[model samples]
Target: MQLSSLRAIGISKSFGAVAVLDRVDLAVHPGETYALLGPSGCGKSTLLRVMAGFETADEGRVELAGRVVRRPSPERGMVAQAGTLFPWLSLRDNLAFGPRESGRGDTEEIVAGLLEATGLTEFADALPRQLSGGMRQRAAIAQVLANAPPVLLLDEPFGALDAQTRLRMHEWLRSVLAARETTTLLVTHDVDEALLLADRLGLLSARPARLVEEIPVPFGGARGRHTLSDPAFVRMKAQILDRVMVA
Candidate 1:
């Protein structure tokens, strides 16, 4: 068996007397997108946070490429629902910030490539306030990628976008991940989104969440708008919905 790029081994967490996660175990393979799907407030984000080292697990450990994750590292970059770009910085500067801060010499090349990759080259001089929600989100993700993280933690990064824009982003993101082969762990309550993006889906129960089922998505790669209507996709969506309804 190949080693997992990111692994959550028997993770559990609680606040006060309320347990949020209950012995959750997950393994995301190299360059594969794995999503944790569940109802709202079901501890999906908590698990992602623990894996990102933003929050420590009470009972277990998180490992990234065989090293125990001790604290937040640029290697495990996280993009949350809200835009994370600096409000005052242009999109170009935002992408360059990480590399420059880390003292890398190729900031210009990295920034230019990210701008092109995210289709934000035109908006490179624009501030976050000047961009649409979707564009800002794209820039947020681009900023993270500029850091060259092997693992990307997405905490409902598209939850705030409108339906149409979100759909478009789904397609764009699929292509980006395919090209970069970034190992991703996404947390979302949207079943369709999870089904559309992930190589495998892990269903989580309500509070004190547990991994109830793991389903492989057979859609292969490069999903588009048509994917939402595909028979297999519809069936899998329905199946996952049914599981979530009962979870």
Candidate 2:
């Protein structure tokens, strides 16, 4: 049976007098990738933070695997733009940090596989400062995946990379997430990224963001770079662009 891996019910948040999110409701099914697309300053990251338990909402609640999320849990791994990796640790050790701290016994094997999967095997002994922006983000992803989280919260993880690198990261991330069947909630301003990666794409209004529309991508499962040229993809991107522009 299908299950909801993450849910936000009537979530509302404000910073001082500036309201950010308002009665936002979101549901990400198990093993599904959901992307929240909106304009700049639309509070997409704020909502993601709330879901990750990095920030609290003034109203409503968020749940992961049916458990109320009151604090950050390793069960839900989060990856932000860049610079999330520990600068002092090598790529391999960074991947092992989470599990080792949690007392998991398979740290060596896990780190080894993660390094290979993320294409960081050669740089296993390299520190975060020794890597490029994209490589650091990949390492961060590997570090989180090492914990084997059921849900992933990504906030513009590739936003800092160049166009070419961003596209590669997108393809890499899609494959890794699919292989693990991990439920993911991505906050992105990139339309093509959302169309290419999301099982369901949601649009949020300007500020005090609320989910204004939810679109289920009809593209068959297992997408790749070629999917970007599909007519359906082009159409959906246009439609979403129109909506976001108007909002």
Candidate 3:
């Protein structure tokens, strides 16, 4: 059998007396984008952390490419909400950091490619502090992509940006992810964002979250900006909204 890009079987987690996840099973195929959506404090981030190997699950297991994910690895790249980019490092330097640290050859080539891929080539030399939130987030993703991870974990990565910026980031991100063909699992509270970015959307229940539903996005290939305005898209959002509100 072929290994999934990412897989979790009966995964559960807790913090002291509080249980955050309960037997959550999910799988993301290679080069597929899966989005997890739920209400506030629904353990979406916790689940992503588990898969990223940042936090251990109280029960169950997470696997990446047929291997158990026991700790953080470059094979599973994560992009968090904020404070991801190093404030002192320039965009170019930040992208180069991973390859340099991992002793991966062709650091310059990798950094240059990331800069161009993320449309950050013009600001390649700018420090994280000098860039806007969206730009920083893009650089953060670029930094992760530099390592050539097979699976990407995104935890509300654009939640901190303004609405307009977030939308633009969505477009840019979709383009980048498509071009790279990297497997991705995104956690988001926004229904629109989930519908726009994912090939499959999983809705989670409230605290001690479990998969409520695995919804396949109704749209066809390569969604565009206008796709969000389509009736089918709106209907899907409404359908998801109903479940998310009550989940």
Candidate 4:
């Protein structure tokens, strides 16, 4: 499978006279996940918003699968930190909304499977208010998957959860993405989260952000940051942490 280019070339974004990002370039190949890690005000979320088309880049371009994704199209979907679901809608209804809106031939069965996969089937009829934080977030992600987006832009998707829940969600996300191998770009401030979930990690400098470093996570039996017990993993984490804190 030739995973297409999900590239951000010399991307820059500004709000009026204040700039958030400058000349930041990101390239995530098909089936690979890249975590964008930086401290607060470093433009991680801003970059994600631009990639999701919620904010337009002031300069540079975004290209997907050889074509420029001009605006917020369903080909791309976002999972926000808040899991911004419709409070009044039931989980099943929320999943139905996207496919139904797109006229994509009734995704009922697909939605059912996704709900089950995300462990939300029992809560399908529950409103967002009735679900736990993790469940609601899972539903939000499932809702996006219903549309079958080729690329997923996750902006601190699990940042709001408790530490235990956040780690569990990372484990769950790995299982979910395994089947599809969907290209993903996740923006996160937590170093451990990035190390655990990403195939590669990119570090950025503070506001008027620029790419500073890229690290490829090793694939092995090491689970959690406990994997840092390995000498190589320990060195990698220390190196990335040093760059992050110093930046």
Candidate 5:
């Protein structure tokens, strides 16, 4: 299978002479969830911004399904760390916001379907303040999904939730992504989350981010995530830790 990959070739970025990414190469195959795992202050989020077309890379190019992603696009949807929702707008309206902003004609149907898909149907009329942490993120995700992007960029999407809620949301998101056959690139530091959700894991170094290591996660399907707790999984985690720490 070709995997309908998303790719970054010889990517590099710098901030006022501080090089963050040093000619990094990355690829996330279709239907495969990839995790960019690294320490805080590492360039994971910045790299994601570059991938999202929010920040232009000084040197590099991004391609999705062989087409260049030249600008910030609804085609590369994003769910950020913070809840990026309108306080005054109801959940339903928020979901419809993206499509409406894009001038898509069928906003109602699109929003309705996404709200239901993300299990927000009952909370459709609720404001951002009325929703729980998980719900807020879910709404943010729904808002992005309403645009029906081929590639989804998630930056610590479930990090705001409580531990229990985060675990539950992880399970739900894994199922949702698999069901939709969505191609995703998720930025997360949680080893368990990376092992559970990612098809492959990319480990990055601090300050100047480089591909310290790349490991195939072997989590082929949502149901396969549990295998991450096995002995083989522990060894893999150890290997990734070694790479991150040494780099």
Candidate 6:
């Protein structure tokens, strides 16, 4: 079998006495987008953080490309729900920061490409406060991608956007991921978002969260607004919702 881009093996975590995760195992394959779907406060973000090495697992370990992950590194980049772009920096400078600090010679080129890729070319000089929520979120993602991480961890990155804006971002993100082929693990409570974006879905039970199911999203390539209304998509969404309700 092909190796996973990121893997959490028998992972568990707890805060004082309250267990948040319990023996959760998940693998995000190379170049594939995997979503962890669960109810609110279900430890989905905790699992993603553990995989990112920001939080250590109490019972198990996280692996990146088959190697044990010890701490956070540029090899795995995370984008959270709230935009993390520097308030004072222009979008261009924000995307350039990582590469420039890393002493990469092609910082300008990388920044330019990411700006174009994220449709932020026009807003390259705009500060985070000057942009819309969706724009800032895209900039945050672009900043992460500028590091060229093989694995991307998305912690409900679009949760704050309005419905229409979020839908537009879904389409844009689909094209971006298809082009870059970055292995991604997204944690979201939105079933439709998960169904729309992921190649597979990892359904988690309520806290002391555990993986209850690993569902394959049958929709293959570039999904659009029409995907939400498709019969197959509707059926799968209903089925997954039922499972989540009972989980």
lDDT, model 6: 0.91
* Better candidate number, 5 or 6, judged by lDDT: 6
**How far is 9's C-alpha from truth in model 4 (Å)?**
0.7
Taking the tens digit of each residue's C-alpha lDDT, what string does model 6 give over 1-247?
2224888999999999999999999988999999998888989999998999899899999988889996988788899998779998999999998898799999999999999888889999988899999999999999998989899899999999999999999998888888889999999888989988999999999999999989999998968899999999999999998998888
Q: After superposing candidate 1, which stretches have Cα over 4 Å from the reference?
A: 1-4
lDDT of 1 by residue, 150-239 (tens): 999999999999999999999889888888899999998888789789999999999989999999989998688999999988988888
Q: Which candidate, 3 or 4, has the higher TM-score?
A: 3
Candidate 3 weakest lDDT stretch, 10 residues: 1-10
Residue-pair clashes per candidate = 0, 0, 0, 0, 0, 0
Task: Write down the worst ten-residue block by lDDT for model 1.
Answer: 1-10
Compute the lDDT for candidate 1.
0.91
- TM-score per candidate, in order? 0.97, 0.96, 0.96, 0.94, 0.92, 0.97
Tens digits of per-residue lDDT for model 3, 1-247: 1224889999999999999999999999888999999889989999999999899999999988778888998888899998478878888989998899999789999898889888889998998988889989998998998988889899999999999999999989998888888999999998888888999999899998999889888786678679888998988888899999999
Error of 2 at 50 (Å): 0.7
Instruction: List the pairs of residues colliding in candidate 3.
Output: none
Span of 10 residues, lowest total lDDT, candidate 4: 219-228
lDDT of 4 by residue, 1-247 (tens): 3455598989998888888999999999898888999878889998988888888898998999978876897777899999968888989989988999988775788788888898888888988999989888888988888888889899999888999898888888877777778889999988777777789999999888999988888854235645537677677778888898877
RMSD of each: 1.9, 1.6, 1.8, 1.8, 2.3, 1.8
Residue 53 in candidate 6, Cα distance off native in Å: 1.1
After superposition, candidate 5 runs with Cα above 4 Å error:
1-4, 224-229
- Tens-digit lDDT track of model 2 for 1-247: 2334899999999999999999999999999999999889989999999998999999999988787987888888999986479988888889999999899888999999998898889999998999998899999988888888888899999999998898898899988977899899999999988887889999999998999999998886778788889888888888899999987
lDDT of 5 by residue, 1-247 (tens): 1335789887899999889988889999887788999887889998998999999999989998988786888888888989789899999999988889989899989887888788889999999999999989888888888877888899998887787788777887888787766789999877777887878889888878887778887745644446656888789788777776666
